[model samples]
Target: MNSANLNIRTDKDVKEQAEQIFAELGLNMTIAINLFLRTAIRKRGIPFDLLLDAPNETTIAAMEEGKRLLNDPAAPKFSDMEDLKAALDS
Candidate 1:
């Protein structure tokens, strides 16, 4: 099959990072872009989910609680796995 050039402009850092990742996975930019395009055509949409990973309020509260517990002087500390198990059982 005859091949054609596909030109796309992206940030220098983004291009470098993506190229590095593709190289590690035994792919180059052309192969990676073609794979993406072919997959998108086959799936009729983006092949991967595009979701914001922002933490929810409940998750944020839990993380804050964990930080507080870590800093608390009275928080119980276990020296070993057996001690932790014994504390949990009590």
Candidate 2:
């Protein structure tokens, strides 16, 4: 079978980190890349979910509220489950 050389450019740190992971998994970079290419070809796209791992607007607002509560001295602090239940029931 005839093969062609593929040249890919990436950040040095990223390449080093990936190389370390692949090595730990008992695969060299070439084998790992070929496996990815084969899987992509079989699936007609990337074989994994690629997503931006950022919080949504609602989640961001909730996190900000949590931080505000954490910093506020007057925020209610429940010492036990009963206290929490009482606070909730009131």
Against the true structure, candidate 2 has what lDDT? 0.97
TM-score of every candidate relative to the true structure: 0.58, 0.61
Residue-level lDDT tens digits of model 1 in 10-87? 999999999999999999999999999999999999999999899999999999998998899899878899999999
Q: Which pairs clash in the backbone of model 1?
A: none
lDDT (CA) for every model shown? 0.96, 0.97
The residue pairs found clashing in candidate 2 are none
Best by lDDT: 2
Q: Give candidate 1 regions above 4 Å deviation.
A: 57-90
Native-to-model Cα distance after best TM-score fit, residue 42 in candidate 1, in Å:
0.7
Residue lDDT tens for model 2, 1-90:
799999999999999999999999999999999999999999999999999899999999999999998899999887899998999999
Cα miss at 52, model 1 (Å)?
3.7
Q: How many clashes in each candidate?
A: 0, 0
